[model samples]
Target: MSTSSNSIARMWRTVLPRRGSVARASDRFQAGLLIFVALLALAALPVSAAIGSETYVRQQGESAQQVSERSQVAATLLADGPDITVNSRAGVVGNSRLTDAAWLLPDGTRRVGKVVAGQGRLKGETLTVWVDRTGSPVDPPLRGAGVVIDAVVLGLGLWLGALALLALGYRLAVFSLDRFRFAQWQHEWFHQLDRKTRS
Candidate 1:
């Protein structure tokens, strides 16, 4: 059987028992808790998926709109910008500092702003800068991989977090049941010993 089928079978075995099987109060409660957790997780799956999909759709739509409303233009550096800082903490690279720059708008108007540039870029150097409908230099819009990545990350993170909470709850339930069972066993043992002594 496939792994998913195997998992489903195992879960059913846990939540279901043989016909006419007897159980103590603690055992029944534990079983009920297990079933509750399973059902809760299953119920949350759709909610999480919907949230992820909604976020992706919204982001993709916004990204497309931004792309349509924005354009990249070459801007001339007006001043020497601060050196770009390259720091890699977890496989992510980022550039820091924006240089004073000016670019011509599509309507033949000049726009001035601080635009991102590489390290050691000197005055009179030209760099590509994104501009919005207003012809103001603006940050680039997110697209493609970024939108999908964010959606996946959010979905997985929420799902995994919920699973972790459920696992912890199940462990606590089992611990409580085990303790109750042990106490019951001890009580029966003591009762049997007392009866034997009296006899």
Candidate 2:
């Protein structure tokens, strides 16, 4: 049999009951299975890490490209936003409000949109808003080490979770084997005691 098949056979042999004899095969099988699962999980960690690192690099590059492509333009608030006094006692609730505003594009064309601003902003107050080349508002993208950190965190979390699960499975398997053995021993001891008492 192949190595994997042999290992499986060995594990199965340990779990199967033996007639008229004590069976310790299950313990061996549990131990062997635990080792196998541990090794397999360990092997997967590197692959996951590599994939995560690659994802980080890709995201970092994309963010940098966005940084280069996106531009911040000063847009004026066309009118006062929602009243700040509405929730003053409750501590600033939804401090930003959308108000109509206008700004000049790089091509000297006027662009008007609803820009977010402070609740009590006066008319023509300058607010910095990010925009893409088409003058459409966009959120700033993460860059540099931020992408790297996020990727590492995600990768490590998944890898650790996988390892932990494998270990837990191994523990449960071992516990099951121990329980079976204890039951078997108890049965034998009771049978012997009964015979001795009858003699």
Best by TM-score, which number?
A: 1
- Overall lDDT per candidate, in order of appearance: 0.84, 0.82
My TM-score estimates for the predictions, one after another, are 0.76, 0.71
lDDT per residue for candidate 1 within 1-199, as digits (tens), equals 8998896665565456567756565666776788899889988788888888999999999999999999999999999866656577654345547779999988899988888877778899999989999988888988879999999888888888898999998998899889889999999999999999999
In model 1, the runs with Cα more than 4 Å from the true position are: 1-23, 84-95, 193-199
Which lDDT tens digits does candidate 2 get at residues 1-199? 7999997676555556456535466665765687689688989799779878888988988998999889888898888877775555777666777789888888888899988877778897898888899998778767777898889988898898888888888888878888998999999999999999999
Q: What are the runs in model 2 whose C-alpha is more than 4 Å off?
A: 1-23, 81-97, 118-123
Clashes of 2: 2
Give the local distance difference test score of model 2.
Answer: 0.82
Report the alpha-carbon TM-score of model 1 versus the true structure.
Answer: 0.76
Query: Which 10 consecutive residues of model 1 have the lowest summed lDDT?
Result: 87-96
